[model samples]
Target: MSINTNQFPADGNISGLPDVTELEKLANELFSLLPNEMPKANFSPDLADHPRLEKSLNLVHDRLPSLFSKGEGFNLNNPQTSLPDPHFPVNKTPQSGFGVSPPAVRPGNELSLNRPVSPNSITTNTDYPGLDHKQPSVAGSGISPSAAHQGNAVNLEDPQTSFPDPNVGSSVGLGHVPHSVAGSGISPSVIQNGPGYAEAFPFSPDTPFEPDFNKLWSSINTFKSTPQIPEIPGTGGAQYYFLQGAGFKGNDPFGINQNPTSQLSGKTFSHIQNGAGHAPFDVNLIKKDFPILQERVNGRPLIWLDNAATTQKPKSVIDRITYFYEHENSNIHRAAHELAARATDAYESARSKVQVFLNAGSVNEIIFVRGATEAINLVAKTWGEQNLNAGDEIIVSNLEHHANIVPWQQLAAKKGLKLRVIPVDDDGQILLDEYAKLLNPKTKLVSFTQVSNALGTVTPAKQIVEMAHQAGAKVLVDGAQSVSHLRSDVRALNCDWFVFSGHKVFGPTGIGVLYGKEDLLNETQPWQGGGNMIQDVTFEHTKFHDAPNRFEAGTGNIADAVGLGAAIDYVNKIGIDVIHQYEHYLLVYATNLMKDIPGLRLIGTAPDKASVLSFVFEGYKTEEVGAALNNEGIAVRSGHHCAQPILRRFGVETTVRPSLAFYNTCSDVDILVETLYRLRGAHR
Candidate 1:
């Protein structure tokens, strides 16, 4: 039959059999690539017999006879013609045997990328490794089908798995995916790293904040692989730089960093009448409050310089302890009466104040102990027992006090672990390069003092913490000397633990604080066992409470704790920052003044030091120097100073140490230097 011009879709007028013949020829060429047989064999190699092809061919044939009779020519192969079944997959007319089309995949339900899927299979949400949820949905507009496929196939909780972004969601896992596509998500903008998002579990949307033991362990392992790097001393004469604009009014311009003066509860500076409350502390008023400072020794006024051992408490600290005992004495946890309630409140309040003083994140992190010695023992027994093993080593400096050195030795002996010593230089400062060489996978802990009590050398604690972290070791700072000398912020230092003595800060004796990171503390077992520390106790077994309380076994020293809190309050009122600056000036001044004295040889000449002067006269024995100073009422310590290794390194049995507090005047230094000069003259 001949086809005429009028029978066509709107775009064109299909006129004749020539157009149909041309279309049929192209279709035949394409079909020939398939197998000879239909559906059962290969009418369409890519798909089975599609339903639309058969139906569309039937409709076209049925209309052909009528259309031809009307002379609206039957052009079956017109490309522009609207066939009855647009869904058909076949390209040729009904003349061909095949006519059906497979159903097109639904738009929203497309099998993305190269992923093959069964038509009857149910769709499920996809998984991505270490990728956050709330990502832009793969089905969302503009997300490619290929990205959806890869996101769909991603495996969660698999250490071997890696996802780039997963935000675009359509990635096929046949090969390594691009970092861009892998990281894509639905609401991808929401998946960012910062303080706000850091609070949530970094990778998981389903179980945010659930501890990822695998990642945690991986981080730990990574830390172990890297050796500790010794911190390079920055290009500055001083370890710390004080900004000039940080309220540099000419207060204490002659400031030698001295110990802070005692602050009376009700007193203010007399000179600044309008700014009466602005005075930090009163030196003259505080002198009367310290009873031992006034006591006579060898017919001369007592000049107490035994700060390294412990300081003489001011009347304020004593009065606070007495008031607590006389007025509100009771057991903290067990009491139900009014006195008990008041006592508990006071004790807990003291703990809160201690938390603030140390700048610790929480009160639960601060454990009340007998002193710094006990605190170190607690960490050794509790954390060391659980975490350290036979191959593990703990690094302690050669300049350690016996309290810091002995407990770790005991722990290492008990556990069959190795003990490593970080050697110090001739000037009593730790040799950082040597310390770095000692850190390795087996180095499980670092316990060091911030200041050398014997030599008055200040150690670089911040640098130590950073190096220990790199070596996969936890660091504990013994701040017995520093806590009272400087303003400390634990977060700024980023150490795992910090310990200090209450007595060193003019607080009551038998009290100290141990600050541990919450996670580390939670993991450690309590070293002691008693009533308040247990959650549930039985003859068979017991589960201890979490953190500081768990470490504290029996009833704690309540009155001393309160007194310590009061002592911290006193330091705050005096401003430790101001005190620190004054002490630095004093330390430099004293160092320079004492260096010029005849026949005097100073020990422990570290560039960085606190306000401690240790020296000996060439013509006199250590005892003779001590006696000479004592005769003039100048109190000082002359011995190994509980640091035998350091003194032995210098080939000295003892050194006369005059440790200064804030109350000591420049005249006092003159008296000691002048008296020494006189003593040398007498000997000559």
Candidate 2:
């Protein structure tokens, strides 16, 4: 079908459309009417002319010159006949709402509309499209109104004269206001309300604005001032002051303040006071202090060979307990009454005495408990529970008492940790090499007895402690036996913890002590809780006190602690070195005499041993030997002695144990050996 070139069907259906040739012809006719190049016009409105009408004329002339100058027949090629030159001034006339005219433009100088005007120049009226003199521009001109009225022509090319871009259309320029306005000698208020004003600027005729440059400059200068550095006064820094300062002289940072040398005054005891330095140890004189030693057992003089089980209380300890009950008996630290004061003084004085006795750095490191058993349990529950992880190992020597072994065994089982044992030699002494081999990174703790209760083997405690420390393990030395027979100096030993029972140390029963490093005690949590341990308490939360008080949760064994203090005083009066030397002599004497008995085997004959003589008789049971000794008024332990592992280590279920203290004599040792010989003869 043939399609028409210029007409479509009346129904508006496109069954017939114009051909491609016809479309090309129509495009050519539209292109021929457009100008070869659009002319560029600069319509700078005269500020003194009818400002509102002039602005409107300028907008129309710039955007649509054809409509605006249709009657004039505007031409692009002619300069004088074309749009007015931007450099030439229009005739100035007093027109309503036009306010004033800008300074006259220089002849033959032109501005290009395509190039941006410098922001510092007196802003032209055409800079804002809708603006008129009737409503002032919110972004004021950089030139003051007075300057403009006085005809001062701005140099657009000079950087100092260039204002911020007027196209920014704000009184406050985008980032920072240009400093040119400040140097222009024009008031800020004039710039805020003058011809350059626009709605985008913060200031207007209704709101006159000004800035406080003095305050701003002062703040900037202050910020740039140099800061002073502080100077320390000593060669070793702050630590030197802490150690040797006037306030810290003679004070130990770890907590102990007592001078060990000052503790050995001549006023400790009357008979021994003068002779304490060079006095010969008289077992007879020492026996006078213990009244129980004079008592008869089964019609014979009581020969206390069971010192390992518990020591007899001295007269001083008994008198101290009586004194507390009669004169100072009261619950301590909770009342303001006189008795409470006395009791509190007595209790704390005892703590101080213990601190001195152990040569601990601080009294705060001492914690009173039921005995060594509870002390070890406290560590297991508090420090052990917190520090042990699954698959970690805790090392214990074969010489540990049941008190030390059981608590850790339960802890290991609950924590899923391994309990490694350090085997002892045939002589019942812990093998130092074997102990060193057992220690590794996985070993968390090494808890050993200072002296074996069953075997009397005095282990190399200081060496063992040092080696464990080198392996990154904490050491807990059970001093239940050693504390009584030997002088204990925790500072010298350097073990993390040391525990001893007061009853075994010639003090009252139901009282003991746990000595720990100040830092370790502070780090360990309290195992028990009650009245005094808490600083503040609520149903939801509680704040506990520091160490010593934290671990001593409730009312302590008051009178017994005072008695233990008296016991320590008694030991100090006699001299620890003297007691240790005397006990060593007794041990040597007993060992030599016991070696001669036939049909008798002495177990635990370590080269370095305490005063214990553990033995077995052929053809006689351990109980029979113990019964024979008791019948003759001799007392000795006749079982595993709560140290089953060491007993079993020596291939025996039990042994007849006759142990000694400082008060035990050579006469007592002769009687014990003579009885053993009698039993051996009967067995034969």
Candidate 3:
């Protein structure tokens, strides 16, 4: 039933269907974009008297305005066409209507889609080929019969009687446009010159919809500025700052005056007690304070004896970080708010505590760097740059960690200065006699580690500093491995520079202390310039702040510093005297056990040693011994330990180092011994 009814329902609404007149109007609009030459007659053969096909093409034509209105163009069927195609080639064949010139290939350029199209090129075809074609018959193309039923998918293969309508375009013929547009082709004048042309749904009576980009951007900016919230644990009806009264007293002498106990008080006690009220200082109680001690590895409790590398944090340090984010989260020195002030107070307070912790003369002497590596570099750049000239001497120890050695080596090479090394003996102890011999008026500086990271040989820092002073050379002590295991008084040692990392002391990572003599730090110029380090600035000339601020050029890790302070607080509560004694006991215990194990050769038998026991098995390699122990839930480090020259000097390849802390127990040593014996038997 082919019914040919012309004239649109002039009500300006086609919520359901489109009439013949509206379709014709859309066809005219599409045809206007093209030239007078290529009509539907040129492309499609049969189109004259097919009433069903005409109606279908008309519906498609009416929907043209609704299609281009979306902000970004989208393909009805192909997802790739969603983005605007500026380089889309326009058909420039002689018969096409538009006067777009034929595209030319330039000699030096390639023509891949990846290459940006030259703006100088002439032709661009945004539309595809055979765009003006329309179909005359719906039945021949296996399409449904009737005017409305034929809808949009009509075939141009049939070549009988047809009215050539170029305005219908390929959109109506092949159903490339949306079905709504193809099914309801509206008027061309309405599409071209109407307000509805710029909206999503053309004829809908509903209000306009638009995305608020500003609102979205504001939300993103808000999220960017906010700091991450910390997690606080709930202790039923207890506050964040809980004070322990006499009723809730612990075994320790500090009992009610503990950090966790007395934080709520106006002034917390730093001095620990040695009263008879507490039980004998038990290692078991100390182990309980570290939560990781309870954690199982392999089939047994974890024996974490890698404290020289890094220590496990107690609850106090973790809780302090939690407190910072929850209550005092803000940028320092800039914000006028209370939270910012509190945060600044906390950060500076931590710095003061670090100053006392290292026995530095003043807080200004304690410059917070990323770690020991950057600390050494700071000296190398400022002091080395200014002091060292051609043929000036700088002495380093063979036991120096790569962090301590590389910076001096770089400075020596840069300034054409002579670099001298105070070599270690077969026992991995420094030859002090040789070091004394190296000291001359030409020696401008001497840098060495207080405790060797690989061998655990504790160097006499006071003696080294005094010897270097005799030659008028400043001394820098790399205290990476020493700080956690021993009492470090920078004033007592009298070194010009002392460096240690926070994480090694059971504090937070990425935070470290660089303790310099006050006068020396003041004399050294600012190395890196920016942010926190500046005083008053102009475009031409900027005046810098003194020492600490001059060195700290970027925003520090605030939360980590708070954690470090808390870690120091925790250590103070436990008593450093007890820590040293306990660690020494464990070292001696482990050393005796290592001696009992057959073919297990211990390296670095220096009389004055930190808690590190470096050993290698005869049958098994150092790596094999380390891995075997690791399988038994014992974690230890192997290989060069970043002191290759010192290891080579001992006439050995490498050694497995198991460094202990105060938290490590005698049982941990037993497990290590058992594992070593089993490994030897298996390998033999």
Candidate 4:
């Protein structure tokens, strides 16, 4: 069944689709122009070119009279804009609507997300390695309860269904008008003749009624900053402020706090530590941070269950990347100009972020590569080529990704070296006894993934590293899967090298990280030599920069590295511990539902695992189940997931995988299970 999410739910609120984060942000800015009592002006239709926004705004503009009737304290003078019924408590999360209006501002409240946060203060230290750089510091702020403000918000049943509804004509102030309005679909003569249409607009087909306010902005007094509600986490163009404590200082007239950091303050947006000290962050609000969550597929709202393959980017991250190109776009270490300096600082700042994020010993230890794949290949080509001689053995777990296996295999094949395997028991966990047997004197490197992407298994990485150290072998922990879900402590793991991709953890593609021990990196020679990597070039010989710069070769993915830094900033604000906890809940919720389904066999049943669910249906092919789910708008990866060995070990060629994230809700899982149950009933 194709889910029509726009319908009102029978229960408390329509919940579980993670769309409209960006929409709320755009609406927030647009709402900043309206008065608390009256929408002095309709937003010029040209505010954004987004078709969904265009249709939604157009519909809302036409339905203003209906809003006045439905809302409390309703009238043109005191136009209280809220999406849900006005009687609902302010603290309750509004049953997951994507309306544009900020919650209603009760008379004399503090500014919400309008406070200006300094760039340097964007801090939050989470359990995720290196992200927890500092705690959110607030000098003067006050906390308030959550509010249900859907003012200016349009509740479209299917936002994708209408760019400009065929039944509706273009309103005034929109830059472009339909060439043939009468022929477009609906004629103005028919509209004027329609029961209430004449009274609604009171204008002929040619002369459109103009709005009250001409410009996009309204009176400065129009904005009533309500401190009770949390700011929408991160927005591309929108600024967010969370003020809390008690008495309104009234220090700044515009409600803009001078001393604010992007570091989450007050209730910490929607996700906060409750009185019981539990991270009960609302997933609905978190979903708003990511704009892409609103994407629709096959005319249905997208349920992004393919998180293991790649996570979605938040507005903060996207904005940061845009800010870089728009302002500080230049190659680093090449010029003495302003842009060059800005670019250098941004590029190096990203490295420091990686250092703080990974808790690497020093900034020099972090090297930017294309991704974890290249990072591994860098290790094989550099240290493997330099240190290892013929007959040296390499140990890899059966739970390894192809990236970990192929590099060593190629190295071993070229050098005539021996390759050893560490077997895994059922449930896809690495066996310590088998691993111990393989770790002999000749075992030069023990490489493995901390978390299996294919099965969602979290290996005992610290133990693996310790054992490898005992055998006098160098250990490399593949953190591609683990970094996003678990706390990473490279020093604590005591591994010689740690590699992960930025894209896997909410950063952009084409950029990854290689954290090498300072000494180990300095000792290794660069395989790819270029301008920046070279200290100086002579006719006879050339010297190279040490460690990171040596391996980085030429101009690296500097912009994306800066983007990775922004991603770290975003994750830091949310706090990884909070994210991990919520994801664990989502995982458990999804797992229980899957287990109850008849004829479903779950792969990778390890007790210590991340948020990946791999299962095969008895009567259904993996691809078939995946297709059925897609028809209803859920996304799941169905294949070997690039870990053929692990799947073959589990007695299956492939499986259906739906991975969870913090943005996912119980409602999403409910819909998923409902579809699967329907499928099973039909099969029976």
| Candidate 2 ranges beyond 4 A from true positions | 1-278
Clashes of 2: 19
CA lDDT for candidate 4: 0.65
* Full ranking by TM-score: 4, 1, 2, 3
Best by TM-score: 4
What is each predicted model's overall lDDT from 0 to 1?
0.61, 0.64, 0.61, 0.65
In the range 142-234, model 4's lDDT, one tens digit per residue, is 000111021111111111111121112122222222121221222222222222321222223242121222111111011111232222334
lDDT of 2 by residue, 34-122 (tens): 23331112212342254333443354345333322322211112211222223222222212222111221122211223323332234
How well is each residue in 1-684 modelled by candidate 3, as lDDT tens digits? 011112223332223433334444544444443334325342243433444344433543454333334212222122212222111222212112211112311111111222221212232322322233333333212222333133332221111111222212222133222111221222222322333332222222231211222211111111011121111234221121121111223322223323322321211111112232221233544565678888888887788977777899876677667757866787777788667776787787788878888988898998887788888998999988987899999999988888888888888888899889998877677899999999998999999999998888888789999999989999999998988878889999989999999998889889998889887878888899989888889999888888888888878888788677778876765556556655654565567557668898888877667888888789878888788888888989888887888888877778888999877766677678778877878877
Compare candidates 1 and 3 on TM-score and give the better one.
Answer: 1
Model 2, 92: alpha-carbon shift in Å? 99
- Candidate 2 at 293: error in angstroms? 0.8
Which tens-of-lDDT digit does each residue in 454-530 have in candidate 1?
A: 88888988998899989999999999988878777888889898999999998889999999988889889888788
